[model samples]
Target: MIGKLGQTSRRYRDDARSATSRRLVIGATGVLTALLTVIQIAAMPAGPTPVRHPLAQGSVWDSVYTAAQAARGEATFRKTCAACHGDSLKGIDDAPPLTGTEFHKSWDGNSLSAIFTKINNDMPSDNPGTLSKPQVAEVVAFILQYNAYPAGKADLAASADSLGGIKFLPKP
Candidate 1:
């Protein structure tokens, strides 16, 4: 009877340990599943979603810059760019034309931000990045006008985000 009692006690202890181990495994799995669910939710895109501007379908024919801005840009171009790009912007020696095939083909289907950035950071050859943001924007407006792009109601803002929203398109 004593030996039987001891065996029964040992068996009960073993059963209790197994049940505890099973409970632990279940609890760990629950925690892991919950963590993964949170991660997935966190990774998903949220509200007020970012706007990615699409490429223009036709050309700069659709009004983009303002006439006043273009006029201001023309003045800036004459003062800073005419010496190198020429009065007609037809390129002088190594200076590339700013209104013809090369300019349009290179910028077509791309964002205006590219042109803004290039001119804002590197221009005039002798002096780089000396032009203020607004000046650069004005110069860009003039170039668009020279390319035969129509003027809009508002002036182009000197901002990368705003410029990035405008795409260049091939002429129709």
Candidate 2:
């Protein structure tokens, strides 16, 4: 009888251990699941972001993006804007700076479209009245790129309507 009782007690002990182990496993799984859920929620996309479009659609000058246009704009800026805007586009005397604090103030509460118009109408101080629409657009794009603005799919050349909405992020 005593031996039987001892075996029964051992069985009970084994059962208790199994129950505890199952509870522990369930608790650990719950924790892991909760953590995974949090991570998934955090990684979801949010807010306005650049809609990447191909270069053929537009370019830095055309008011859209096309690898071809950005390339062309780059060349245009080098030929025309490089003299006063500096090789790096930092800008020379009497020419409003294009990056850093000066850039922020020059464009505070302003629209890119307006900026484009100003450049198109009055630039190169020495030869202000002779730029073509596409040429002006290319130079404007170079300035945008210099200001650290990321390229978007659509070129910003057509009109100031869309450009007015995209606000500039001031640099430190």
Candidate 3:
């Protein structure tokens, strides 16, 4: 009986060693294959890159500031700004609305620059100024639409200096 038990123990140890060796072989093969694949990828040729303006800090308003832009802006606002401003752009429980008499009260006498600064500096509730200037302008256009303002031929300026020159006109 003792002889039989000693043989069983030896077999078990041999099996364990063989299993460990097999696992190491598989692991090494996998690492080598991965290394080869990465080398192949790095050897591939690169593609040409597109050109972009240096000071393109954000979006620049162009002649494209149309009804379509306003509509598009509205969609962006609804998805990103609606939670805080409500669907109507009126402030939510703790948030302020984007339009109406209350909105006018907060910004009517202010210049477009002031409005832009407020939005660019402190908007979107969760992530302010994170949006590009073009996105911010689109949002402004949507707010204007809600307040019954007319669309202009050009998009609002995208640059801070240009934005400062714009004045927020009170809706008639």
Candidate 4:
């Protein structure tokens, strides 16, 4: 009976040792995982701050498109944009108005280049992105003329960089 008791005690000790070892291993694994996660996050490289376009900081009051260009733009607008925007650019059903208080409010304090990019990529519902660079510039000029912005002697350039250099300002 004593020998049996000794054997049982030995078995109990062996089982307890295994359970303690297993718990130690699990705790170590959790600690190691947390350490590795922290190390990975710390090792990651930092990214640069985003830079705003020069035009975004400027104003539409600055010299821009010419009167002749606006006239040409008006002609193109009549042919291409009149259907959806209406003959007077007042907009139709589902299409937002392209002029007046609402239009100016939407574009106020924004970059002209952003507007140009939007029009270049998407316009004329049935035939989006079909307008040429110069044609796009002309249409922009027409919109500016309609808004009553002062016209300059030089024409507005169609390039993104040039357009971005011109900011959209609130009407005086």
Task: Report lDDT (CA) for all predictions.
Answer: 0.84, 0.67, 0.71, 0.83
Model 2, 85-104: lDDT tens digits are: 77776778866567777777
> Across residues 27-135, which tens digit of lDDT does each residue of candidate 1 receive?
9999999999999999988668843334333335557789999999999999998999999999999989997888777888878888899888889888988899999
What TM value does model 2 have? 0.56
Q: What is the lDDT of residue 66 in candidate 4?
A: 92
Per-candidate RMSD, Å: 10.7, 7.6, 18.8, 14.0
Please identify model 3 stretches exceeding 4 Å from their true place: 1-65
lDDT of 3 by residue, 1-172 (tens): 9999999999999999999999999999999999999999999766577334333222222222467668878888888888888888778798987777777777755656676667788887698878888777777777776776656576766555666544554432
- lDDT tens per residue, model 4, 12-108: 9999999999999999999999999999999976658644335433566655889899999899899998988898888899777889888878888
TM-score for each predicted model, relative to the true structure = 0.64, 0.56, 0.58, 0.64
TM-score of decoy 4 = 0.64
Worst 10 residues of 1 by lDDT: 50-59
Native-structure RMSD, model 2? 7.6
Best by lDDT: 1
Q: Give the TM-score of candidate 1.
A: 0.64
- Model 3 RMSD in angstroms: 18.8
